[model samples]
Target: MKVIVFDTKPYDRKYLDKENERYGFEIKYIEGKLTPDTAKLAAGYDVVCAFVNDDIGAATIDVLVDVGVRAIAMRCAGYNNVDIRHAFGKIHVVRVPKYSPFAVAEHAIALLMTLNRRIHRAYLRTRDGNFNLNGLLGFDMHGKIVGVVGTGQIGRCFIDICRGFGMQVLAYDPYPNPNAGIEYVSIDELLSRSDVVSLHCPLTAETHHLIDAKRLSLMKPNAVIVNTSRGALIDSAALIEALKDGAIGGAALDVYEEEAQYFFEDHSNDVIKDDQLTRLLSFNNVLVTSHQAFFTHEALEKIAEVTFENIANLSAFRGNRETYLANEVCYQCEKFGGDCPKKNHKNCF
Candidate 1:
C-alpha cells in the first residue's frame, strides 16, 4: 500500500523506514501536519498515517475519503484530534494503543526528579562557572505520597517507579485493578494528600480539563504537578493562576493544550503569540518539554510496527473482522445508533 505519513519528524522517518523494510510499503513522509490544507498531499495514497498533533477533523476526513484513502492510521494512542463522529462509515480509523508504556511512565518520573532537584537550573549555573547550590534544596521522596490518576498500563508502570522511591501510591481510575497493590481513592482525597500528582488518562468529555481550579485548590500548597498525558487534561489558564499564587509548588509538563501549533517544530525566530504559554515559561518553578515522552527507540519501533499492521489488517480484511485493529471504535453505533454488532464491536457499521 502507498502510505503518506504526515507530521513526520526525522526520527519518525528513521524508524518507520527501518521497519518498512519488512512490510515493503511505499511510504512518503511529509514534515507538516495533516490539516485541511495539507490533506490534498495524500490524494492518491491508500493510507493516511497521522501523528498526535495532526488535525484530522471532519474536513480532513472528507478530503481523504474523496481522494480514495481507505484507512486512517494514528501513530500514537490518543485520538482526540480525530473527528470520530464524522468519520464513521466513511474512512476506517486505527491506532497504536499500547506501545511501550514504560517510555512515557519513565518520562513522568524524569520530569518530577528534574523539577524537585532543580537539575535544569543547576546545569545552567555550572555551565557559567557560578557553581551555586543555595536554592537547590529538595525534599526526600522516600515518604512522599504520589497521586496517580488513571491506573492503566502506563499508570501502573509509574506507580512502580513511585513505589521504588518508597513513596505511597494513591490511584484514581473508573476501572480499578485490585492486584496493582495501590490505594484506590476518589480524586478529591488523592489531590488533598499527595505530594506529587501525575496524570495518565485519555482525553474525553469527562476528562477534559480534569485538573481545573477546584481540583488545583484541593491539592496541597506545595505539591507538584506532572502531566505526560493529553494536553487538555489540565486547564492551562487556571494552572497559570495556581502557579502565580503559589498554590502549587511547581509543574513539569510534556504536553500543552495549544501545543499542536508549536510542539514539534522550531519557532526560534518568531515571537510567541500565546500569552498563557509565555507566562507559564516565565516561572522559575515550571518546566515544559516538547511532547516527547514516547520518543524512545523501543516506543517508536513499536508504534511503526503496530501502525503498519493496522493498515495492513484493514486492507486485507476489508470485511467485518475488527479484532485485528486494537480498540477500533464503531462511531456510527457508539454516537448515533443504539445497536452495535456484538461479534465485531470494534468496527460495527
Candidate 2:
C-alpha cells in the first residue's frame, strides 16, 4: 500500500521506518503538517498517516477524498483535530488508542516535581555561578492532596505514582471507573481540595475549556496545575488572568492552545507574535515544554507498531463488509455509547 506521512520529524521517520520493515509498505514522509493545502500531496496514496497537530477538518478530509486517499491513520490517541462527523461518510479514521501510558504519566510527575522544587530555576542559577538559595523553598509531597482530572490509563498510572509519594488522590471523571480505587468527587471539590492538579482527559466538546475562570477560582491560591493532556482542556486566557491575579501558584504545561504554529519547530531566532504565548513565557513561575509528554522511546515504538497495524488492517478489509476495524473511531458510535447502528458495515464510509 502507498502511504504518505505528514508532520514527519527525524524521530518519527526513524521509528516508523524501523517498524515498516515488518509490513514493507511504500511510505513517503513530509515535514509539513497535513492541512487543506498540503492534502494534495497524498494523491494516489491509499492512506495518510498523521500526527497530533495536523489539520484533519472537513476541508482536509475533502481534499484527501478527492485525491483517492481511503483512510487516515493517526499515530496519536487524540482525534479532536479530526472532523469525525464530516469524515464519517467520506473516509475511514483509525488511531493508536494507547501507547506507553507511563511515558505521559511520568512526565506529569516530572513537571510537578520540577515546578514544586524550582529545579529549573536552580539549574539556571547554578549554571551562571549565582548559587544563592533564597527563593528555592518547596513543600513536601507526602500527605498532600493531588486532583487527577481523568481516570484513564495515563491518569491511573499517575495516581499510582502519587500514591508512591504518600500523596492523597482525588479523582473526577464524568464516567468514573469503579476499579480506579480512588474517591471520585465533583470537579469543583477536586480543584478546591487538591494541592496539585494534573489533567489527563481527552479534548471533547464537553471537556473543552474544562478549567475556566470560575473553576480556577475554586482552586487554592497555592495550588499548581500540570497539563500533559490536550491544550484546550484549560482555558488559556483564564489561566493568564488567574496567574496575574495570583489565584493559582503556578502552571506546568506541555501543550498550548495556539501551539500548532510554533511547537515542534524551532523559532528561537524569530520573534513570538502571539501575545498570550509571549506573556506566558515571561512568567518565572510558569514552566512550558513543547508538546512532548509522549516522546519516550517506548511510546514511539508502540505508536509506530500500532499505526502500521491499523493501516494494514484497513487495507485487508477494503472490500469486506463484515469485518470490523477495532481501532476505527466512528463519531456516531462513540457518541451513543459504542453501540454503532451500522455494526454490520466494514467502515463508517
Cα-based RMSD of the predictions, in order? Answer: 2.0, 1.1
Error of 2 at 143 (Å): 0.6
Best by TM-score: 2
Best by lDDT: 2
lDDT of each: 0.89, 0.94
Q: Per-residue alpha-carbon lDDT of model 2 for 1-349, expressed as tens digits? A: 9999999999999999999999999999999999999999999999999999999999999999999999999999999999998998778999999999999999999999998999999999999999999888888999999999999999999999999999999999998999767999999999999999999999999999999999999999999999999999999999999999999999999999889999999999999999999999888789999999999999999999999999999889888867878698887887667776767345455
TM-scores for all candidates? 0.95, 0.98
Please write out the lDDT profile of model 1 over residues 106-175, one tens digit for every residue. 9999999999999999999999998979988778999999999999999999999899999999999988
Q: Going through the candidates in order, what is the number of backbone clashes in each?
A: 0, 0
CA deviation > 4 Å runs, candidate 1:
319-324, 332-341
Would you list the clashing residue pairs of candidate 1?
none
Model 1: number of clashes?
0
Task: State in Å the error of residue 143, model 1.
Answer: 0.5
* Ten-residue stretch with the least lDDT total in model 2: 340-349
